[model samples]
Target: MKQKTIYLIRHGETDYNRQGVVQGSGVDSDLNAMGQAQALAFYQAYQHIPFSKVYTSKLRRTRQSVQCFIEAGIPHESYEGLNEISWGAREGKMPNNFDNEYYSTLIKNWAAGHTDYPTEDGESPDQVAQRQKPVIDLLLSRADENPILICMHGRAIRILLSWLMDESLATMDMYEHSNLCLYKLQYDYDTRRFTIEVANDSTHLLALVMHH
Candidate 1:
């Protein structure tokens, strides 16, 4: 039985994130200064791991989160499949009281068996899950001893984990993804199963907080 490991990460914060604005697939925001520090901190901590490949979403934030590794000559590929879910009319909107209330109601509806229901022109949870298929498939097909690193958005990470665990996407809200947090999963080729080794871990960023 061979074991394959995967490191999953959520992209660091963007200016939109700092400003309490919605940054979905359509927004395409870059990492802010704090975000850059978070990325560097993550890299400095995990550089010891010999990552065979790197994967990221087409968005700038995901790629920027791993920019250090990419610049260090580590090979990587971008996939649109890993992009964040669209928030439609709220894509780049800074949340006001009304926006906040509306967003909450929207999420409430989605959780109430309306997963396919969209807010404005935004994507439904089902649509996000659909695009995540290829990313999941690629992970399952990898050979043992190959360690892959992936950087994507918060919602997308939750969707990927839900799919991998064979759980409902509605339950994805249970997983909390902080900036630069990581999850580690080990796949056993023999049993054809994935066992989570780490979840929502941000211990590596403790030292970096003083600077931020």
Candidate 2:
């Protein structure tokens, strides 16, 4: 009955993130200056945790954010499952008034529990859930008695957490994560369950904010 833990981290900010553009599965983007700072802070904050494995998305932003952990001598793995949702045609496109309206309507439908609402070339909420479930299961199964660190995009993290917690995608939308935010989940082998210890904690970011 050994305990297991999973540390879920959202990658730092990107240029597109700052610009409020949809980055979907377009060409990978690197972190901005603030994002680099946040990633470094994340490393400093959790250096003592002794993570058994570090996982990150294939996207550049997530990989870069966790690069500090690799430099610190932690072994890590990357998975495409951890990548953000594909925005299809909207990838890297700056949203105009019309685009904003369309995106907002899509989001509103999703928020109202319409998981199957089709996006022109984007994945629906249910589709995201389906894709992430296998990855979540794999991570959970491998976390027998060790702690794992997962670095991924914001939307991916949210969808995975929603599935893990058995909450609806609509309800999960209420939770927002800032760049490099860290979330902790502890699992009880005896009960075969996991509980969230912390959600979207950005204490390290706050400290960096205060310092600068």
Candidate 3:
């Protein structure tokens, strides 16, 4: 039986992230210094793995997080389907009482299994899943890219994991994540099933000293 392993992680932090600003799919931002350090730590720890390919969201933050692996000559590709869910008008906003209240309500809606609920001028969880399905199917079919490394954003990673783990979209928050956190998974081609080998692991960043 052919099997594939996926090393999936959230991109490192950005200035927007540090400042509590929303950076949805629409906001293309760079990694901050602390983020660069986190990336280096991850790379130093796992650089020896025989990763055949590197996959990331089209976002710069995602690409920058795994830049080390790409620089090491691992084939890399980015896909829009892997981008973070767009927050529409709130893409660059900082949290205030008003926005925070909106977000709280939004979160509650999602938690209540309203996966179809979307932010104003943005995408719903279901819509994000629809866009993601084709890309995931296409990547999984590529037998040549086994044991690939994937870098993405927080909400997007959770959504991807929900379906990959065969759970309802409402259960995605159970797969908690932080900047540079990892979730390793294994897929069995014959059985068409995926197993979670690791979940929300960030041990590699334990020694990361945040300067700033």
Best by TM-score: 3
Candidate 3 minimal-lDDT segment of 10 residues: 203-212
Best by lDDT: 3
Each candidate: what lDDT? 0.86, 0.83, 0.92
**How many residue pairs clash in each candidate at the backbone level?**
0, 0, 0
Assess every candidate by TM-score.
0.94, 0.93, 0.97
Q: Please state the error at residue 139 of candidate 1 in Å.
A: 3.1
lDDT of 2 by residue, 136-200 (tens): 77877785538889898877777777777778887767667888988898877688776889988
Q: Candidate 3 at residue 23, lDDT?
A: 96
How displaced is residue 178 in candidate 2, in Å? Answer: 0.8
Sorted on lDDT, highest at the top, how do the candidates line up?
Answer: 3, 1, 2
**How accurate locally is residue 160 in candidate 2, as Cα lDDT from 0 to 100?**
75
Q: After best superposition, candidate 2 residue 93: deviation in angstroms?
A: 1.1
- Model 1 CA deviation exceeding 4 Å by range: none
Q: Candidate 3: list runs displaced more than 4 Å.
A: 209-212
Give the per-residue lDDT of model 3 (tens digit) for 37-110.
99999999999999999999999999999999999999999999999999888998888999999988988898
Mind giving the per-residue lDDT tens digits that candidate 1 earns over 29-78? 88988899999999999998898888999999999999988888888999
Model 1 CA RMSD to the hidden true structure, in angstroms = 1.5
